[model samples]
Target: MLPWDAPLAGRLDRHPFTSELLRGNPLGDPHERPLWVYVPPGYDDSAERYPVIYVIQGYTGQVTMWANRTAFRPSFLETADAVFAAGAPACVVVYVDAWTAYGGSQFVDSPGTGRYHSYLCDEIVPWVDAHYRTIPERESRAISGKSSGGFGAMITPMLRPDLFGALATHAGDALYELCYLPEFGKAARALRTYDHDVFRWWDDFRSRPAFTKPGDESLLVAFGVAACFSARADGTPELPFDPVSGVVEPQVWERWLAWDPVRMAPGHAATLRDLRAVWIDAGTRDEWFLDLGATAFRDEVLQSGLPPDRLHFELFDAGHAAVDYRYPLALKWLAERLAR
Candidate 1:
C-alpha cells in the first residue's frame, strides 16, 4: 500500500449545512457543520439515481476524519470509492457531522446535546435528497457507523423506519452492563482528586490540553453520554452513578439502559422485520465487549422476524481501532441489497 492519497473513481462533494434544529444548542456548538457526499463513478455520465448510505462517526469523530490517512492505509474515502470502481455496486455516500463540546452527541436528540437526531433525519436527509440524484424512499436509504456511530446506526432505523430501511454497525455500543458499568469505578477513582465531582473534573479538563490527564476518556464518555441519555430537563448531564462511591443510581442508570440497542430491539421488532438488510460485525476482542453486544443484537434482529437471508453477521479477528477496511465491505454489501 502506497503511503499517499489515492485518486477516487467517484466524486466527493463537501457542503456547509446549516441546521435550524441545532440552533441555540445547549453547548453552543456550531449549527453549520461540514457535510461530505460521495457520488459513485459514472454518476456524471448518466442521469441514473443511486442508493445512498449515510455515515456517522464514533466518539470524538467529525466529518473530516474520513479523509485522515494513517501510517500506510488509505482513508475510508479512497477505499469506499474503490468498492464501486471494482464493480461491487454504485452508491452515494454521505458523511455527517454531529460533534459537540463534550466530544460527541451520541446522535440522539437531547436537551444537553441538541436535536441532532432531528437534524440528521429531518434536515440532512431531505437536503441530500433534494441536492443529489438519490432514491428518496426508505428502501433505497441506509446508515452506517462505528462505536457511537454504530449505536446511531442501530437506533436510527428503529426510531425512524420511514427514513432508513437498512443499517451497518461495527462494534456498535450496546449491552450497558458489559460495555459501560466497569468504567464507573475507574471514573470514580479518578474523580477523587476533584472532591468526587465530575463537574470539577470537567472544569479541570477544560483548563488543560485534552487527554493530558488520566481517566479523561472514561470521564468524557460518562459525562458526554449522560448529556445524551440522562440529562435533566433543564439540560445538565446527570451522572448515572455516584462519582465518589461509584454506586449505580437506579433511576438514571435505567434511563441509560433504555437506550441500549439490546433492550431496544424487542420493542422495535416490527420495524426490524421490515428492514431490507442489516449488517452487524465486531472485533472478537473489542475493548468495550461490543462483540457480545453484536451477538445480542443479531439475535434480536433474528428474533424480530427479519429473514435470515437479509442479515449479515460476523466477528472478525481484530479489535476496535483500525477497522476502516470493514467499512467498504459493508458498503458493498448494502449497495447490492438496497433498492436499485
Candidate 2:
C-alpha cells in the first residue's frame, strides 16, 4: 500500500476535544485530543439513528495511528468502510485518544495519569451522542480495543453498564500474575543505570531513541503502568516492585491485581450478565500469554452467569503484533448484536 491517506466510502469526521477532567493533569499531557467519528455510507441520507462502537488504542497508541497504512494492506478505516459498503450491519465508530507523556494513560483514573476513564464515559460518550445521529442508549453502544485498549474494553462495560451493554476485546491484558510479574525482573535490571530510580530512567528515556536500550520496553511499560495503577495521592508513580532488587511490594502490587480483568469479573458478575453481547479473542501464541488471560476471563464471565448465547470467544492462530485485521471482524460481530 502507498504511504498516503486512502479514500473511504464512509465519512470520517475529525474533531479536536478539550477535556475538562484532563486539564492540568500532573503529567501535563495534551488536554486537546483528537477524536474521530466514522459515519457509515448513507448515514446522512436518512433520519435513522445508528449504534456506536467506541474504539480505544493499545499502550502508546495515538488517534492518528489508525490511518497508518501497512505494506500491502489497507488501513482499518478502509476495511471497516468495506464492511458497511457490503451491506453488513451499520454502526458509527468513534476512535478515542488517551496518550500521556509516559506513552499512555491506560485509559484509567489515577492521580498520575488523570481522569481518563471519566473523560471517556462522561465527556466523550455524551459529546458523541449529542453531535451525531446516534441511538442514545446503552443497548446501542459497544466498546472494542486491543491490548491496553482491550483491557479498557473488558472493564468499561462492567463499570458502566448504563453506558455500554456490549464489548469486544482483542488480546486484552489480564491474568496479571502471568502477564506483568515476569517483566519486573527486566525492568529492575534496566533500573541499575539510573540508581534504581525510575524517574531518572524516565529522564534519560526522553532524551534519546525510546527503545534503543536493552530494557527500554520493559522499563517504559513498567513505569507507565505503575503510574496508571499505583500512583501515590500526590500523583507520583510508585513501582509495584523494588526497582533494583525486583522484590514485590505487596501493597502496591495488590492495587495492580485489583485492576486485572480476570480478578474483577467475580465482583462485576451482575453487570456482565446484564450485557447484551460480549466478544473476546486472543492469539494463541501471544507473547504476553494473554491468550491464557482470555481463557480465564471467558471462564469467569461464564461462571458469573453470563448467558452462553450472548458471548463469542475464540483463540486465533497468530501472535500479538499486526493484528489490526481483527478489528473489523469484531466490529461486525458486535454490530450484529447491538440494537438496530
Specify the highest-lDDT model's number. Answer: 1
lDDT of 1: 0.96
**Which ranges of candidate 1 are over 4 A from the true structure?**
none
Model 2, 16-93: lDDT tens digits are 999999999989988999999999999989998999999999999999999888888888888888888888788999
Assess each prediction's global lDDT (C-alpha) against the native.
0.96, 0.93
CA lDDT, candidate 1, residue 190: 94
